[model samples]
Target: MSDNFSRPQHTAPLTPILQLVNSAPIVLVAFFAIGLSWWFLLIGVIFLVVGGFGYWASWQRRFFWLNEEGELEARSGILFRRSRQLRISRLQSVDILRPPVARLLGYSSLKIEVAGSGDSRVILSYLSVGKAQELRSEILALAKDERTSTQSAEPADHWKWQVPNGRLVASLVLTTSTYFLIIGAVASVAFALVEPGSGLVTLALAVGGSTISLIAGITSLFNFSVGRNDRGIAISHGLFTTAHYTVSPIRIQAICVVQPIAWRPFGWYQVAINVAGADQSSKKSGPRVLIPVVHEDALPELFHELLPSWNLEIEDEWLASAATSRWRFPWQAARLAVSLTSDLFVVRSGALTRRLSAAPHERIQSIRITQGPWERKLGISSLHADSVPGPVRLRGRGLASSVAVHTALAELDRMFTARKSRKSEQW
Candidate 1:
């Protein structure tokens, strides 16, 4: 019964029917269907009308109002008329989502995440593009103001890692190539088993499938974007439902940078962080946002701006003193080896890109050390690391064979203990 409508920080006008009609896929599908039957055309017309009204209704129900009182109000659900109220202080992270059509319509959706148990959250769709920007700016200002008021000294810049374009290209090529190969292999096998009479049909189907895969890969390029500014990082990506994530440094629990095998050639890597209440995916999924590609050089700057608390020493000068014995190692690696290693250890050092040292630790969920028969004979071993966020094994991608299995266990111990200690301190 609250009749007083508070002032909204921003508002988005509902997208119209003309905007939906402009979509290429919908237009193409509707055109093709109409050509097949008058009945189809009738159904299409009805759909367009009903769908437009529904879009408007959904828009009306999904508006938001952020007042000067440091509170956020979201109105949603057409029939149920549900609304949520929350203090801005409790907000965890604010995510902006824009679908392909939403992009064309120049609008985005907003999700206000808060720290609480169960399904306590607020989401508003159809926020005008301008309003989304304003809201982001406002939130950043408020968060900064609050922090500045509380503390006199600011944290130093430490973490500086962003996805590189080269890595993105490499990832795209690898993904597309694998998909095409898989499709071709499967189609060839199927055709070989089929009768000769349908040879032409099978060939056509194969070509069509390959073309779709190529298109999908091309579409993925739009998913590429950037993350910047002081409030935190904002990543924009997706083919259908374009996702935008805005994370603040205060909420970050851990930040991890990973380089997978496929991207090793291009020196491409991914950066993700374990954040508090921000990892929206299931418990099995990795941390919040995945910057699928990034240059190694930029990581230092990005880290400094985003996570000042890490105090990461990423310079080659510092690395020089860390030591390498046919294998590179960090100060933490020595501790890992001491605590985790049962007997043998593996230490691998790279002149440029990768350096690893691993050891076994107590109460390990899974520990694996792998080596080829040649390595086995030579008494060399490779160490593997795994946890709830998934495994990170440094064995492959060109490390030496002389590294013993014992080295790996120690490295594992070092890595886990450091992380656990850091986590405990944060608490």
Candidate 2:
């Protein structure tokens, strides 16, 4: 675990121009929109150039190196002089992003995400695309204990599946956009009905925000794809602003497959995952997407390929035997199901937003069994596989026979104990 290698301290040599290129579109839009005088415009140009130079100067002082303890050490900032270190073992994912300008310049940005809250990580921008990929693979290989002091020119490639362009567009357009559009229409109507004078302004804001959301959703899914190689499952997508995300199987804490009510007719489902110490930090599902739009039949195959440990075959049998307690909420229980395997537990629920969530035995930070007054009478319990804080909780409610409930809980506890022992021994 001890290796020390350092890069010469400097920004990407072309970062200054890259900054200018990044801001060009915004600058041009503002220039024409405001119609400033020639002198004022010239001053603006000078200010931007100076700012870019300052940013490049700051990056020049930044140095990134691997320390003896296998942590990434970053020394940055000009006036502030900030230093940070991220342990290689705690690293979650390495994402590569390429905005159009960066791609045009043959450069890419590396985003290093670790296991925790907040945006505490490293970012090396405007490196050659090849260099970024090399760095990503090299760092990821460390966690698997497969890397050496010597280097390889390219990361190993094992291509899996690329989302079809048609499917991506259909998925985005059919779901969130439609919801936003309906809300915009209703809100606009309500505003007009409530206050005539302010109606136009409110309507304009509602429609505008919805339109922007729709556009952003569509843009985010552009060129979306997923693959697997030696290190782990890799995802790459985006049109104007491209990004690549990779996660090792061991770090995949949970996975969810969702099918919107509208998408059910089409048999389309969107898959999302929660990694050990990472969050998309976006309100939208853009950051967690495993598959944007996939048919029901295709999901098992994809899950098998990307996550072989998660077996979904148990789903059919589980659904048949799913709790049929008449006391269970009629609306929610019918659509709910759960499946179990030696390594993973899957929970399927949701009415309008049908969800199938799964988590590995070791990832279960805690397990809880709860019984309501009605459920206690019915002799049923709700089982929760609790992990780190996330937007969704994975659980199966009103499953029959307290015996079955206790059995599952005991099994989870045993698995959790065994996994912890194995990890402690490895360390």
Candidate 3:
């Protein structure tokens, strides 16, 4: 706690580049809206104003290290100047990000993420690209130096890094699906070529629009990296501009491995850490994404490194195949017989991966049993189990009817609620 070790001196602190990068969206917005109305010019002016203020703020911010004290500090802000200090002992993970423009300029950004240390988020925006690896090694050395002085057993300094294999493919999929700039460019050009008025203006807009999209795509692909080091997990991503996220072990709330249909063929899954301090505005954007997209086999290593308490075996406990109900089967059959007399009815478990699962009583968030008029006449039901992200529904179809659905919901509720009231015990 004394902060006695010698730290490196600041060497021409990196200029803030992320601020410039955040301004790109505003410019793209202006270009795409060129011929809409006078509002387009107004929007451009608004972007200029915001970008100018951001540039001023960037100039005001500076991050550096103190040689004698072995501490890192960053001071920044236009309206509210803020500074954060960190000792080497509390070091967590260090990450590097380079947008295409940053790479072109031979510069890379460094984020020194620390845990146990309060509010010491350091972002160095314009470090020499050539020095990135060397600087990373130097920082780790400083961290090791602190550990040696403590006389306690030093933690292993090795970091587990997960780099995505299909990052470019994923980027393309996202761009083609969500990005509107390409369509905007085409529209702008087509109108410029064929329309009567403002041909030159439309042409300029189309060219500008295309350039931004290409730059954005290149920047996005070059900037994604996830790693778990001494302190915690670090996520750094972006193309022209980048954001750095550091989450401490003690602060982690939940960890979920997500698999989408698109990634199924490659056996790829994404690991997300739900922590209290994370910005959860977007599903893709996180306080950090530890591993962007990697093979399922690699999950164990990543989870063990980042979340020591996590058990991948818990996947076995998720519901897959439905259970057979003796009493309900007859009821369901009778209902299905009557309902299907008019129309066909189907029932099955929602999980694609078949497995045995006993739903934990305490974990249940909500339970509902629904019946439409047709199903009501047949005495059948549909059951839903809701959670934070969404609901998992199990339809009993016609075989068991309402009795089976109600029984399952009641059993699940009892298990979840009872567990909540009991003392700590092994799962």
19 Cα displacement, candidate 3 (Å): 8.8
RMSD of each: 8.8, 5.1, 11.4
Order of quality (TM-score) = 2, 1, 3
lDDT-based ranking? 2, 3, 1
Model 2 — TM-score against the truth?
0.77
TM-score of 1: 0.58
Candidate 2 stretches with Cα past 4 Å from truth are 1-7, 20-35, 45-49, 64-73, 83-91, 113-120, 137-153, 183-207, 279-287, 315-330, 339-341, 369-382, 398-427
Per residue, candidate 2 scores C-alpha lDDT tens digits across 372-391 of 88887777777788865555
320 in model 3: Cα distance from truth in Å?
A: 8.4
Worst 10 residues of 3 by lDDT: 337-346
Q: What's the lDDT for all of these models? A: 0.51, 0.71, 0.51
Identify the superior model by TM-score, candidate 2 or candidate 3. 2
- Could you give candidate 3's per-residue lDDT for residues 113-136 as a string of tens digits? 666534555767667765665566
Per-residue alpha-carbon lDDT of candidate 1 for residues 131-212, written as tens digits (9 for 90 to 100): 6656655654555555554422222223334334454555766654556665766766677677544555656666677667
Candidate 2's clash total is 1
- List clash counts for every candidate, in order: 45, 1, 12
